[model samples]
Target: MKTRKKILVACGTAIATSTVVARKIEEELEKRGIAVETTQCKASEVPSKAEGHDLIVATTFVSGAGDIPVIQTVSFLTGVGIEADIDRIISYIEGA
Candidate 1:
């Protein structure tokens, strides 16, 4: 396994929503003994910013992630199905 995974967390803007999602991803993954480094970016920036990242978690729609995996969901903010999403995120990272 990689020592640390890179996750791109994006929302409508680069600030508020991404912060919340990034923190949630980090915390949940840490609890599972997975370490992650997160970058917060605007949804519009995903295509340009996704190259180096292991996974992309977006609160809004995003395309152009290429070979990297992308999970677009708002469950982190809505507090619904977040556990499943975390597991999904882990699967992608572990597979990578």
Candidate 2:
């Protein structure tokens, strides 16, 4: 069986918008039968929290440090460009 991909979703703040983004990604990935684990975190913790995850998704541009693949997108909450961006991220993870 294939292992589920773990993802870290982060923004400047964790409460307000990052939670929404994380939920959306979870829902979308589930619909495609891709099991994913999402953790909402502050942007500053992304580098540390991303360990062991398949991807790190940030709502804003992240600078410095992280070995895993990263997807920079703010649309996960706004619902704009979310589908396409998420699709690309998923494809990259799967293809890799």
Candidate 3:
């Protein structure tokens, strides 16, 4: 496994929503024994901020993620499909 996986968590404002998402992702990844480094950003900034990151998890739609995998979800806020999202994240990390 990679030493650390870099993740970009994006939301409409990059503050409240992204922070929650980032925290959840960090906890989930850590439970799987994967070290994670996360950066929070606005959805509009994803194109630039997503560079060099392993994955993008956003509550809002993100465009121009380039080659990085983007998992668009509101599960972090709604408490639904959170497990599926985590599974997808793990898949991306393992595959990478």
Best by TM-score: 1
Query: Candidate 3 lDDT, tens digit per residue, 7-71?
Result: 89999998799999899888877887877899999999988888899889989888999999999
Which residue pairs clash within candidate 2? none
After best superposition, candidate 1 residue 14: deviation in angstroms?
1.0
Candidate 2 lDDT over 7-47, as tens digits, reads: 87878988877888888888888888887878888888876
lDDT of 2 at 92: 63
lDDT for predicted candidate 1 compared with the true structure: 0.91
How many clashing residue pairs appear in each of the predictions shown?
0, 0, 0
- Score every model by TM-score: 0.94, 0.87, 0.93
By TM-score, the better pick of 1 and 3 is 1
TM-score result, candidate 2: 0.87
Ordered by TM-score, highest first, the candidates read 1, 3, 2
Candidate 1, residues 1-96, lDDT tens digits: the string is 546889999899888999999998889888988889999999889889999998999999988888888899999999999999998998999888
Off by over 4 Å in 1: none
Q: Indicate the worst ten consecutive residues by lDDT in candidate 2.
A: 60-69
- Candidate 3 TM-score, C-alpha based: 0.93
